[model samples]
Target: MTEGLLTAKAVMERLSQSGQRVVTAESCTGGLVSALLVHHAGASDCVEGAFVTYSNQLKHSALDVRDETLARFGAVSAETVTEMAEGALRAAARATVAVSVSGIAGPGGGSDEKPVGLVWFGLAVNGKKTKAVSQNFEGSRTEIRWQAALYALQLIAGYDE
Candidate 1:
């Protein structure tokens, strides 16, 4: 199994044991994190749902992310990912944790500041609290996505503690 899948599986098991549930908000990795969660059998017990917000408009409309934040920080900022995590938690009330990802995973869409493979992740737990972190990966689009998924899953696994 891929490291991401194994991490996700372990996280699901932990959440199930703790009687907790999880939700996902995705961007660059698209729905890959969510897909991994549900890939395992019986994941429905712990996976609440997934929100795939590819566009800034969708991020605002679906996740209630502030337009000003998006305008100020852009989609891949830590601010945006934190909002996404909080919004996912709000949307999936049953979930005890939410993990979010946003990034520029491409051969293009890079700037001197935010280059390709720039990813931001956010984690939110039941107390309405959230944390956001950024990572710069080096690889092709596929590799970056795989790394993002792995990181997202690892973050989720560590969220409760």
Candidate 2:
């Protein structure tokens, strides 16, 4: 939380200053990214909207994540998150940038391929190119979600660079 304060504030301040708005699509982080952005003052100037698609149905319905993508790659894949970010951008229309997160954060559901704390992030900015990154953190469910949120904020802050 402390680590993300400066980054989240800087992200909102920079986005607001540049007159760019941000939208978020979330899964395992469950709107934690949006919560972090909205925590700071003046965030309304930059934040456009956010969706907490914790279920695959909502991921497909709300963020337009493709059914085939979800079937092939599952909910926690880069493909799913990329689609989630792009879907958010297209749906919101007003936002110039968007970020999406999906992962497995739990004391259970840790597979050999996609273990717990394994998170995939997608960033779409200026409609140039979308970027996706996969990260694995070690902690309780709460800590993993917090780390994922912090990383999402960092991604948004770096999108301009």
Candidate 3:
């Protein structure tokens, strides 16, 4: 099995044991995190759903990402992903946890401040403070996206309570 699948299985088992369900809001990874989670057996028991909010408009419409937040932070910032995660939790009634990913996984979309392969991840767990973190990966666009998806699963699997 791939690393993503392994992590997905672990997350599924953990959430199932805790009676928690997960929802994903994806930007750059394009639902890859959600797809990996559903690869596990009995995934529907732990996965609520996914939102492929690739565009900023979709992010706002589907996940309720704030326009002010987007204008201030852009699409790939910690603030945006945090709002996306929290909004995902609000959108999915059954989801106890939400993971949001936003990044520039590309060969062109690079800058000095927020270069390509820079991914921001947000995790919002019910009754816990929302968390955001960033990772700078070095690889092709596909590889960066894969790494981001794997890391999102890790975030879910490593959540404490």
User: Which of the numbered candidates is closest to the native, going by highest lDDT?
Assistant: 3
Off by over 4 Å in 2: none
Between candidates 2 and 3, the lDDT winner: 3
Which residue runs does candidate 3 get wrong by more than 4 Å? none
Q: Estimate each model's TM-score.
A: 0.97, 0.96, 0.97
lDDT scores for all predictions? 0.92, 0.91, 0.93
TM-score of 1: 0.97
In terms of lDDT, the poorest run of 10 residues in model 3 is 1-10
Arranged by TM-score with the best first, the candidates are 3, 1, 2
- TM-score: which is higher, 1 or 3? 3
Least lDDT summed over 10 consecutive residues: which range in candidate 2? 1-10
Residue-level lDDT of model 2, residues 98-147, one tens digit each, is 99999989989989999999999999886488888999999999999999
Candidate 3: tens digits of C-alpha lDDT, residues 74-139:
999999999999999999999999999999998998899999999999999999999999999889
Residues 30-109 of candidate 1: C-alpha lDDT, one tens digit per residue: 89999988999989999999999999999999999999999999999999999999998998889889999999999999
Steric clashes per prediction: 0, 0, 0
Clashes of 3: 0
